[model samples]
Target: MKDSSHPQATPPHPAEDVLDHLGYRLKRAHAALRGAMDQALREHGLTVPQYACLEVLAARPGLSNAELARATFVTRQSMNVVLRGLQDAGLLTRPATVEAGRARPASLTDEGRRRLNAAQGAVYAIEARMIETIPGERLSRLLEELDGMARALKD
Candidate 1:
């Protein structure tokens, strides 16, 4: 017989418990990575969001702000803020589009491209240092699991 009135009478959930533990660890790891990357970028006058905007613009020149928002999984308003900061820094340019009446094409300047390229090594180093263990197979599996979770959540 079980005592339902007892606070400890509940059965432990294997799935939820594992997810909670993993989520906490993942958050902590992400915070640490973000902190290190932010510190590294500070000297260059860049934040994580700003760096991401530069990278995306460098990779896909002439992207509209809306398209950038979609690609970056950010709101258009939020991306506009990033664009403004980058533009103010002379790292990015948004020229009025000749093809469209009101659409502006976002592109990175030479300086922006150079900075993005320079940051790549630091980004790679951070990722490598963080995921140095757990083997390649496990890392791949973890990535797959995360992708699956993303897909499921999106639906």
Candidate 2:
């Protein structure tokens, strides 16, 4: 049916008690993590988005802006800006002209690798702190449930 092509988006109903809502708790955790990351990345002169792009590029080189944007949970436009800033900082490289299509592949330079490696310690420390807060046995189940929640929302 033609109606199948146009699915309606339904907003989630909020719980009566905001404090007891899963969304509230998840957002609080996210905000806390982001604040910590902001402080940690600031010491190394990188924003969270910038650091995310570098980390993703280091792991998988020669990814285009659109690909990087998807992998880093950012928009393609935002990724372009992040890539340009990194390139200007001598942390990464993008071709002057596209060798083929519109997508110009991006890769981290030696300095980018060095910077990411340095920033990893602080980032990892933050993760370690979070891990310590949760019970050891529950961590895996927590991750699984979080993944399930994300998948559910996507559907």
Candidate 3:
């Protein structure tokens, strides 16, 4: 029994503590990764989202705005702003007239490829640094676990 006037301070449960919370740890890791990528991308005048769009466009060739929005985990309006910036910088292109649907499919330009190539080295280095922090034997498991977690939560 505890007194109502002066309640005892409860000891923290290790598993239930905020420091051990999965969501908190995930958010912290995400922020660290984003910050690192942002720093690496700043020299090239690119934001993390812009670089993500470029990377996706490079791999997929021609993706509609909405498709890109989904792939990048951004709103269509936000993606439009990113696309406009990239287009203005001559890093990507869209058809002057929509020949098929309302969505404008975007493709990387020669400059876009060049820029992506330039940034890839730095980005890969950052990834390598992160991977090096984990044990070699656990790397695959870590990746699989992350993918599984994401899949489980996606509804």
**Candidate 2 lDDT tens digits, 36-155:** 999999999999999999999888999999999999889999988999899999999988888579998988899999999999999999989999989999999999999999999998
- Estimate, for each residue in 13-74, the C-alpha lDDT of model 3 and write its tens digit: 45667677677888998888899999999988899889999999999988988999999999
**TM-scores for every predicted model:** 0.80, 0.87, 0.88
Error of 1 at 114 (Å): 1.0
Candidate 1 Cα deviation (angstroms), residue 34: 1.5
Model 3: lDDT to the true structure? 0.91
Model 1, range 78-133, lDDT digits (tens) per residue? 98998988888889888744664766888898888888888877877888987897
Runs off by more than 4 Å, candidate 2: 1-16
When summed lDDT is taken over every stretch of 10 residues in candidate 2, the lowest stretch is 9-18
Best-to-worst ranking by TM-score = 3, 2, 1
Which residue pairs show backbone clashes in model 3? none
